[model samples]
Target chain A: MDTIIQCENITHYYGQKMIYEHLNFEVARGKILGLLGKNGTGKTTIINILTGYLKPRAGICRIFGEAMERLSPAAKSRIGLLLEGHVQHAYFNIEQIEKFYSRFFPQWKREAYYELLKKLQVTPVQKISTMSCGQRSQVALGLLFAQDPDLLILDDFSMGLDPGYRRLFVEYLKEYITAENKTVFLTSHIIQDMELLIDDCIILDFGRILLHEPTSYILERFRRFRFDSDAPAFPANDILRNTERIGTHWETYSFASAAEVERELVKNGATVSRLSEDKLSLEDAFIGLTGKY
Target chain B: MYTSLFYKEWIKARKLLLLLLVVFAAAVAYTLLTTIKQFHANPVAFWEFIVENNSIRTGYMRYLPLGAGILLAIVQLTPEMHNRRLKLTLHLPLDESKILCSMSGFGLALLSGLFILSGTALLLGLRIYFCPEIVYSDFIASLPWWMGGFTAYLLTVWICLEPVWKQRIFNAIPALCCISLFYTKALPGAYVPLLPWLTVLMTAGFFFPFYSAIRFKHGVQ
Candidate 1:
């Protein structure tokens, strides 16, 4: 896979509190990487660092093989970013906003912008301050899409968007990803909504990465097992973190191969009914790994 | 790129610019009418008026450009700072110098418009009634100085209003000191020379914020 963004040993701190330490990851081109984290988990901070808005205390972040700090205007022009809050200037009407953004981006497509506006049912003459949250998001999305950037970074793009608009945004993103073979990094709290769109997921908690893997690999490896009170304890291994007993039954979470775990359970004389093979979502994986309710 | 940024700044501050223009035009008309009335009531008194109030007239003329500069800077940047749109601006692919240049260019353009409108009204008044022989070249030559003053004032406000250094103490202290200097007659005799010096200082100061903006872009907290 062609890596588009490589973050190596990046550490960031807020005063004395470390937000992220020794973080290493690479986002491959032509794929959508969903960043899953709860509120206050430093998702926005990471995005800020990636976009060169914030500097890390130590280590390097490279975009398209160039250090983010030393990225030229030409390299920056190829990346589009949508911040979490209102991105549009309040005084700017839609037409003015489009005209303004189109100037900075050399690849900006005016026809595509107007087409997206029409598809989103947004009028170009309306002032941004007067628009609803959903409408503002549509405009921001329109601007990003029109930029046609090689790498798109969205900081919680789904926030404040209604269900219909959310689905529409997903469809548009999918189409863009397929049509242009562009890479996307999206951070969102709404994992259920992202389940259908994310090719890979990263679960972040308390300034550390708990899991990073393709969706299919996560489903195939991790299994949640439930047994009666008398079930024998699973063998200790690096993959087995903890086994908890709740009331008359016990639930064990393990990172071992699912078949191996199932066989171990059968050998231990515990009644093993293959629970539903439902895949664990990003949110479920996050909660399971973090041990947070 | 500069043209587009200039256009964006114009759109952002157009309403405030229009309002300033209207007030400026009215002030120029009033100044012209008062001067003409004095000249007609008594020719001797009119000449005396010119001599006695030459300092005041000069001060007023100087204040006109400075005040406009300060007001334009405040109005242009305050909203962007309040809304945190400045961050978005820095994130754009354009260089920091270009962004600052665009803003300064727009301010210069607005200053030019004000000068032309006011200068024309004064000339028309002179033609219609006062007929005072005035050195148009001197007035025209002084425009760049005025533009420089206003640009500096605008750039100062932009830097001061940034979230990082927006301490009330910093803003209030300088204002209080300036007022004290004005009221207590403590302003230095060298202050008059500093006006031209300030004009240059301010013109140069216009680029400082852009440097700071570049530093800000690099995440220098």
Candidate 2:
């Protein structure tokens, strides 16, 4: 794989609280990698580290073979960053903002930006601060597209978008990235959108990465198994990631085969008369790996 | 790149700049008109007061430059701190210090322009009624206060750029102390001997904002 972003032995903390320790990951070129985690699992922290906003306690983050802290101006031009809340120069109107950013990037695509802006149907004089959250998102996205960077690090792209705008953003971003083969590292609260956009995902639990795999791999193998249990207690084991019991019915999640799960349940002294396995979406797989807590 | 950065700053603070300009004009006009009216009413008494008291009639203008500096810094920098929007600026394909320099440079440059305009207008207006010695003394007397404007603007940038609230408040203490130095000797020609020191402080003030910018970049909060 042609690596675009690499982090080695990254350890970070806030005050005395460790956000993550010895965490490592790499993003390959031309791949969309979704960072899925709960609210405080350091997803944004990773974005900050990758973008050179935050320095990890003990690690080196390099993009395009250059340390993030020392990325050259030329190297920086190759990477586009979308901050949380879709922040841009809100004081500028759509036209003025475009004009302002165009000077920095030699290869700025004016049409690429305007095309996205057209979909928003905002007038040329519409200041970004006056626009709705969804409209602001489109403007931010438009700037990124115009920049046409080789790597895009987007933190929580679906932050405040309505369903229609979210879908529009996803579809537009997908078409653009696919057409240009751009590498993307993004996170979002909305997992369904992640399912539609990310080619691979890194599911982070507290202080550790639980799973890093392709979206298809998790969707294909990870599953939810529901079974009936007359016994009051269900034993904890590595095979079943998480288990919940309601009355006599027990629902569990695992990546194991149905037969192995059934055998394990029987050996665990549970009266499992029936066992059913249901395929999981990305969100389901995310919850299964990280648990529903 | 510098032009674009300046353009962005211009757009952000243009309205405030216009307002500040109006205020500067009004202040200069008011001071000159009041001086004219008082001098016309009692030319001999006013002349005696000017010569014996060694006081220029521009006391009301003492805080105008300082106010301009503060307002300009607030208008220019407050939005950049909002929602951590400075990250977008630092992320630009330029050296972080260079970017910050351009930003602070723009604000300082605007303040410089306004100060020059008002200062020159006051001098020319004073020239109409006073001798070279008196006008020169008054201009010299006002230098420290104008220097305060620059220092205040820089200090405010330092405060606004600091990512940590505690550190921001800490920064303001020394800033206030430094600003107090400019006001300590307000008499005509008192600051003449201190111009060298004030220049040194103003030079240091130019770079003070970078400390906060670095902290912000490191995610010090």
Provide the lDDT at A107 for model 2: 99
For candidate 1, chain B by itself scores a TM value of 0.71
Estimate, for each residue in A134-164, the C-alpha lDDT of model 2 and write its tens digit. Answer: 9999999999999999999999999989999
- TM-scores vs. true structure, each candidate: 0.84, 0.98
TM-score result, candidate 1: 0.84
DockQ of 2: 0.86
> Which pairs of residues have clashing backbones in candidate 1?
none
Top-scoring candidate (DockQ): 2
**Clashing residue pairs for model 2:** none
| Candidate 1 positional error at B29, Å | 0.9
Candidate 2 segments whose C-alpha is farther than 4 A from its true place: none
Instruction: Please state the CAPRI-style docking class of candidate 2.
Output: high
